[model samples]
Target chain A: MTPSTDSPPRIYTAALAIIGNEILSGRTQDANLNHLAKTLNGWGVEMREARVVPDIESEIVAAINALRARYDYVFTTGGIGPTHDDITADSIAKAFGLPLVEHPAAIALLEHYYPPGELTVVRRRMARVPEGADLIENPISKAPGFKIENVFVLAGVPSIMRAQLQGARAFIAGGRSVLSRTVSVLVGESKIAELLETAQGQFPDVDMGSYPFFKRNALGTALVLRGREEARLEAAYDVLVGALSAAGIEGHPGELPD
Target chain B: MTPSTDSPPRIYTAALAIIGNEILSGRTQDANLNHLAKTLNGWGVEMREARVVPDIESEIVAAINALRARYDYVFTTGGIGPTHDDITADSIAKAFGLPLVEHPAAIALLEHYYPPGELTVVRRRMARVPEGADLIENPISKAPGFKIENVFVLAGVPSIMRAQLQGARAFIAGGRSVLSRTVSVLVGESKIAELLETAQGQFPDVDMGSYPFFKRNALGTALVLRGREEARLEAAYDVLVGALSAAGIEGHPGELPD
Candidate 1:
């Protein structure tokens, strides 16, 4: 939602659509989601949701359409390669009801990257893009990713996708960045659930979470408080630490070392 | 859709709903999706889609409702702990339009696990589930997960979730297992796209995928063929290897050593 002229800054949101059968089939572990989430967070864009869909055209189209409608921006990874299973570009075109065509810039890039007479028909498939789309630079490889409206299509390879994301930084409009603080204690989550509930009630604006961890066979819980306002986050952290101390538990300032 | 009594076995499909803020915030990398996908696949259930949603109640309920309607079985992990941020139980109840009530078996489990007078009200929160739900056993910890209709709820921690999933095995009905074979060629995907395409056309029953990788500074692609019938999958693999050999590239039998 847009903010009023005198209101506070509006928070930007994004969603990721991972289009690959390898991920859904357990053949390949997805490495792009965490990197994308952290990168977007640093730019003040919150990644609100993500979906891993197979290479099926209908599934990819539906996921792209659903995410683009709800989030400020939608990004998709995978299905843009030259192989037969790489159907991301065509699926995205279908999702937007547009025709797929060869982009002149993409073709020129591919032609220049490959040796003379080596850019075969199948290799040139990477030059195809949805009509009326802008190309996102791929530094690692000659083939470029494309952007159409609110959806940004990226490669599935982690290194190439990270490079294209950097090129996409110019297109994203960021808002106020959310900051967080963490406190860890050598106690299980259930041991401090009531205190955490009370602290959460006291600071309703700050989003709090408790994650249980096992360190050297000792059970512990990490309490994290996140908010856009630094002052509010600090206050909440202090209150949480004070409550833990009152209950005769030592709350470390940060997460325990592994 | 069900198969005829005399027809071949039907392939069962499942969808996962991962509920957590840590995953979306980039604080935690998800470790459950791949494990669940592999486990379900081994049991002859294909993981068709997965969604990572925040801990918001509305989002959780919406994701659950959407996934459950489309897949044969739906699984959810995270947000079932005792902390205030844990709201999966309530959201699931809302999704099914059922009342949230304390399960007697769950209470007994928790009471038996914790020390005397330690199972406080907040600790007892884990015992609450949707009305008319069956309990899923937790081997590591005493807090039990629950199953309501087609949806199975598990914990966020990897070890605990894996244990709970083993307990859920009895409730699932599996189909024919999908088998796969991989051949790695020391060439980029673009170099062999046409050959792979032709091979895929020859064996339409097998699901083919090409994944490019860079190992030891050498570019290569892994060609994978999957199908329910072992003979068909092997034939596809043979065709792929033959195509690569005709193209003057050696095809390794399996994935490249890491």
Candidate 2:
């Protein structure tokens, strides 16, 4: 991708819909959202929002519809297994008004994985995909995830989800990547709230955030600036560092607040 | 909380809005949602949904309004700090049409925590609360969280958040708590997909879920049944186990899917 010199760089935003009763019920702590967010960031895509919904079909349908409409890409994790409760593929089909068809490629993969006599009805469920969807290759498991429209359906297991994401990333079109810088202030965030707000106003395009952290007996804040333009981000970082020095607070580079 | 005998016992639902750029940026993994969900479940409240939004005011306002309107109770974490980026309190006030005021109790707590010369302008920011809101005590830190209408605003720090939650729990009136039982079958979830669906159909009121897991190169599924009625939940669990046994798969109790 060529870097654009347009006044405002192109911005690509994505959203995640985590579908699982296991997550909502607190039985399983979700590890996919963070992984996806970091991965997407590296690929020049911003994950703007994320929602964790139950395994219910209607809930999954609603979230997919809303997110796919609002964001450039919508990636859904969980609820794609071969169980009665695994309803993500069917829900995505319903959301897009497509038929749930058994994909030939997926069936072939499953057929090859399981013995000729072992391809039961339950195993066949894994081969079903939304009509006209492209298969997302899964190296760890033979059952493939599929992408329909702008929604990518991946397995819930962390390992499978990461692998599926790597495959899906190759097909995605990314915009200008976001550049970030974190400056750790040796004082509580409250002490520098006003200065941070002033700096944010000066750099309206850059998203500035102050996170307070406490570790051992020390308290500090990490001032993070994120923007699509590297030059603008560095300028904003300079402004933040200068403001901290003016307030008689020492700012350290690359030192994250606990 | 009373155990009710009424068929299809009352179910209380809640939604959480996690407000912070740290979480969205993947700089911080939110620890509040799972803790709150587990805690609320013990209080007979089911946390149905959760949304993670950035520190932007408009996003926070929109999420708070939507969640508060849909669920029985709405709990928000993060962004209620003493920083310029800590806009959760103001955004929440805007959402409910409440005036931002210096809460007397909050101010007193700050005053008591800081010495005569230590209460700076930034520190006093924590004293602001929505008008007519009741203070949710913060035992770890002096600054207090508050409750306005159906929404509860807590400190973003995990320790302070947990303490504030403990104080706020007493004011909530709980309905019938959900009873859950998990049966682990030493077979793939797809192997028994049809049976699970049929059992789910039989117990329509119970929230049935099947989670697939992989451990030590072995794959299995956990069948979970949740409902407000213990007898009904037990009945559903029995049905699931019986179905597994009929399918020649042994169902183990309390054995979690990996």
Candidate 3:
């Protein structure tokens, strides 16, 4: 299905910043961003941009300055750890010119997990929060996340991060999540080029893409169709499928096009 | 691996930015960071920070300004699509105070993909290059990527971005990679918390983590151990494993404790 000239068009926006040395060292694979994107999509929030920076203070500060000013809500993961490298709170504070002080609420939580004086230099790192920032609670762990302005600074550890965000969810913006559909075809992407061109022209409001993959040694293509308007997207998707059927290509009816 | 106490540890760095309005709109899930991280880890480069931005010019410029000055390399993906929202090229050029030029190499590659002038205003968006940047060749599509000072501009599509990266690998730094190991334990993370704490104390050089996961619907913990000093790390791992084995903990004989 495709959108006609009479239909209203669609758009989305998002900003993602991943903070971790483990990810950069090629030591670990990060599955969080993609997961976040999918979840946001379900809620109709667009993830507009993503950035990755290191564990350095200056670097993190600079990145915070850059993203906070550009995005509706800047989401950062990875550096809110109980270690020396966990400098996100201080960084965000520095970016906003706020004072980073040990918050009474966070200190209470810290004491629950760590006995007095057990929270060493590294562990104490997790308790510091900037002035005027609200706490994003962590049900799994005692240390809470903070939301200053619109930047939601969460823990880098997945479980802790998820719990904190769960507590912070309602305050975030909700949008009309656009619809998506997929059309798979056995024809080579090169062969399906003309049809893709036609589909795109026929439905300018919808985004149509041809992803070619190799399965069992033969070239296969998956055409992904997406749009904000449901009826228009459905229309363009149907037309794309019809064109694929006419071309004698066969695949699934509705898997992700990519 | 653990770092030798005597040797000063130096951390490698990187920055990532995802550019696209679709991502913001929750229309598409991004798989590039994980894939790219896998590649980066092979070379031991650490991804310090990441951000996602919408298809806005000033936003991209602002991000570029902050990241370029702080990290060894800044990577940007997406927004090079053949659509009105694809304004990455011009913004990148503008960010560096460089003039936008019809890059000869990129134009030639585009010509090879679709005949000269067959590219409309939308498609031509992929061909814009900032002055003084080297083109990064796209293996999936003919359109190439370009590199400015400390910045590698690649495609938004995963396959195309990956192919372009393969073409850009030679430009990475030549630092020796950080090494790590993983040991699985058939026990809950809480049960092993004491041992983990003890082991970390004994092997201060190793960074230890306990990751819990479900196998056959049963909970198990995987200890990921990382560091720079090979011998010290190996020795610590052995001692840590020995202690666990003595305590009836099932673990690898030589898998260093993380």
Candidate 4:
């Protein structure tokens, strides 16, 4: 949906495809999704969906195709290393039905970074890119991430992936950033579910969520209101606060004190 | 994939469907997927895939149907609360072509938990369940989660979801647990990519992953070996250790000290 602004803020949705067996196998915790979600949100682009697929070529291709078609941009993390399990690059190429080629720039960068004789055949595999793709510079590692059309292939490592994302910012055209406010109530969600529903119904455009928490032998719910319009958010917050007061509950702004 | 055992170990697969907008909007970090994956692994069941959909009914139904058909079991977290946004039960019922009915057991539990006159119309909504579904006990809260066929609908809150999972374990018929060993090394993945590949090839049953990390101004990779057979895992570990030694890299068991 378009936001009311001088430029009718275009809604851009992006999907993330995480490629690795480690993540799926519960061996490694994926640190990329949260970081990428926060980063994209800051840039006014919504990270709509995320899929974690194994290193299988068919799975990667399917995930890439589905996400890229639905969202404005599709970012893939992992499977781009020089190891045998590193199949993301080829899988992405296969998704687009394009030939995987060794880009001259990528090869030169790898050559410049590593000593002449040190650049082995396995290391050179990192230079392979899909045909007609642009390089997303990885300053930390010389082996650059590539962008083929709407798909961006990033490194699996968190630090390298984040570094590549910095360069990726230039390519994305974001819109109005979503803003939010939280109010914590010392009551159960069921006790205030009707109140929240009423508030939500009143502010049709804003999204209100009630998250219950248990702390220090006390139960409470954190009511969060999120939307693009700050004025509307403030209005909705006031309504929620008023509703809680009427229900004999004290509403605290932001998170409840630990 | 069948593992080599006295009687081939049955590989039971599961999928998790996270139903919430907070996760997709970056407002909440999903604590369910990791916990569920780890728990399933312990039960000798593999968590094959995970999908996070919004509060939308159609999305929930689609995810539920797809995951349930593909995997042996499907666990859905979030959207079971007594709020307007909590439409998981209805969506699940719609998916299975079952009528949404008020379960007698769920109503009794809620009635016993809440004081007289406290159980309002909104609070009573929690009693609704799919026809012929078994109630999942919630120790922390009175409102019970329900298991419809292969899908176990649990609360979104971490503590409650975990509590419900304890009860769900009784319903699942788990297979042989998968085992793993992590070998940390003081060399880049590219430096030992071929070595790891060779080790992986040697132990065909063991799945090996090389995850590179940068710590204390040094880059290294963590080689994780996983298999159903403990003997196979041990054999793969020795092979990986030998490979690292051959490449003049020191390999350490478990994770590298920070």
Instruction: Give candidate 2's TM-score.
Output: 0.94
Candidate 1 falls in which docking quality class?
high
Q: Output the worst ten-in-a-row residue range by lDDT, candidate 4 chain B.
A: B1-10
State the fnat of model 1: 0.85
Every candidate's DockQ is: 0.86, 0.71, 0.25, 0.68
| Local accuracy of candidate 3 as per-residue lDDT tens digits, B75-193 | 88876655444578889999999999877777667677776667554455567789888888766657578899988888877878999998888778735455677777777555566
lDDT of 4 by residue, B62-110 (tens): 8799889989999999988888888999999999999999889888887
Candidate 2 clashes between residue pairs 3 or more apart in a chain or in different chains: none
- Evaluated with TM-score, which candidate comes out highest? 1
Report the TM-score for the A-chain of model 2.
0.95
Off by over 4 Å in 4: A1-8, A139-143, B1-7, B139-141
- Which stretches in model 3 have alpha-carbon errors above 4 Å? A1-19, A26-28, A38-167, A172-258, B1-12, B112-125, B138-141, B188-206, B242-248, B253-258
> Rank by DockQ, descending?
1, 2, 4, 3
Instruction: Please list the residue runs of candidate 2 whose C-alpha ends up more than 4 Å from where it truly belongs after superposition.
Output: A1-5, A256-258, B1-7, B256-258
Q: How accurate is candidate 2 locally (lDDT)?
A: 0.85
Using DockQ, give the best candidate's number. 1
lDDT of 2 at B85: 79
Two-chain DockQ for model 3: 0.25
Given candidate 4, what's the lDDT at residue B221? 88
